[model samples]
Target: MISVSSISEFVYCPVKAFLNQTQKDNIQTREMIHGKLVREIRRGYEEITKQNMWSIKENIELEYIFSTIFEEVTPFIKKVSKKYSDKYEMDYSVLKDICNDLEDDLKLESQFLSLKVKKILNTTSKRGNEIAEMFFPQSLLEFPLKNEELNLRGKIDKIEVVNGVYYPVEVKTGMPPSKGVWLADALQIAAYVVLMDYELNKEVLVGFVDYIKICERRPVVVNSILHNKLFGVLDDMLTMFEKQEIPEFKLNKNKCEKCEYMDICEYYG
Candidate 1:
């Protein structure tokens, strides 16, 4: 299966993708390790709850959300409660666990919102000094996507719903561009939109790249051009899979230096 991750590697260098699949695991770099840790933090953030400010009208107090949380969570509990019905009070415990999970998630979300506000205040744009608010009103974590016909598959880190529009949100433990997103990152988000569109039968127009460490939210708009690129890359990916031949190495010393496969690749110099 062609992973969304491979698109970025191919963007960086086709040889890197070839090496990534053909070779065994190499030592993870500091950046790689830090990235893994950051992902862990994000994954920990999985649950229901938010310190949402922008979405709700000012007249509504934040306490209203908390008061209604149980009402909102009840349907979910009832839907899944059968699994625990056999045990004594286990179903009740499950409900309690769910509530606790939501509460914890709310705390993390509060922190995240605070950080976002802080960042926006610190930034000054050409238009003038202004603060920005970027948040997901509703989000589903670790969502899976697959297109069997295309032989493509990957898990989306998040699917954020704002108003009624749905978009994928990918968290990166790396640097983001001053303008737009990295090619690989764009491809990944595009793939998510494609898979989601197929599965849901709804058009997914945009997605986000969350550079978590820097607290930057970069939006990626999926267009015909990117879709064409995705198709081209999928073809290339399949071709490489069929041939089982490592593609020619692009002579970029800096790229090689950063690649995990450098130690084992035949052309590394």
Candidate 2:
């Protein structure tokens, strides 16, 4: 099966994707390490959020919400910090610094969510369950989706059920674009949207990319154009994989400069 991540990587750079398919060794860097830390923390946060979402009261105060989020995520923060520290061979102090910074970030996110929830409560006649469904949305974390007909499969970061509709949410720890989502992200979400549509036997018109760094949620419409592009890339990727052929490099100096396979890529180019 063609993985959704491979589709995004192919969109980012076909050569890089092909190399990744062939190569097994992981080249970890500071950014990669930091990304792992953020992903682990976010995964735990989502699990806690899903569990506590139903218990939230409609008339809950913002401070209460903030404190609840903080308290719920505290043990997780320490646990993830300690685990990363030992695994990465880092000092506890350094992990503490990262945790402190994340605390501020999560606080900002909490404030943002609390305000949204409060606004919904004040403006709408919806009760606690409705409000929870609106924001938290009974999400499935790291949900695997597959479509045999399309020969594609992937694990979405989160699949949220809102108003009886399933929407794919892809969490991005890296920086997002200034406007809209990155093309690679949009394509990734589109692939999941297609998979979800097939799996649920419903037409899912939209999905979301959650940019964690900026706390921004950008919607990606699952339109004909997006589907066309996604399928085109998938076809090319499949052919390349089958033939074991190295795709011609489309030179982007910026991307290539930071790419781990840059030295090996020169041979093909």
Q: Which candidate is the best by lDDT?
A: 2
TM-score of each predicted structure versus truth: 0.65, 0.82
> Which runs of model 1 end up more than 4 angstroms from their true locations?
22-33, 45-112, 115-136
Query: Taking the tens digit of each residue's C-alpha lDDT, what string does model 1 give over 1-269?
Result: 78877777887888777765555265443344434434544454333223223233323233453343223333443433443334323446644564455445545555555454444434533111122224435677888888888887788888887777898999886677788888889999988888898887769888899886465789999999999988888888889878986566558998878776676667877
Pairs of colliding residues, candidate 2: none
Per-residue lDDT over 1-269 for candidate 2, one digit per residue giving the tens place of the 0 to 100 score = 77888887788788777766666246554545777788889878766754565566666787876666556787888898888888888767877888888878887877777787778767887765676666665778888889988888898888888778888889997788889998899999889888877887767888999988888899999899998998898899999999988687657878877665666765434
Candidate 1 clashing pairs, residues 3+ apart or interchain: none
* Predicted structure with the largest TM-score when compared to the true one: 2
lDDT of 2 at 58: 64
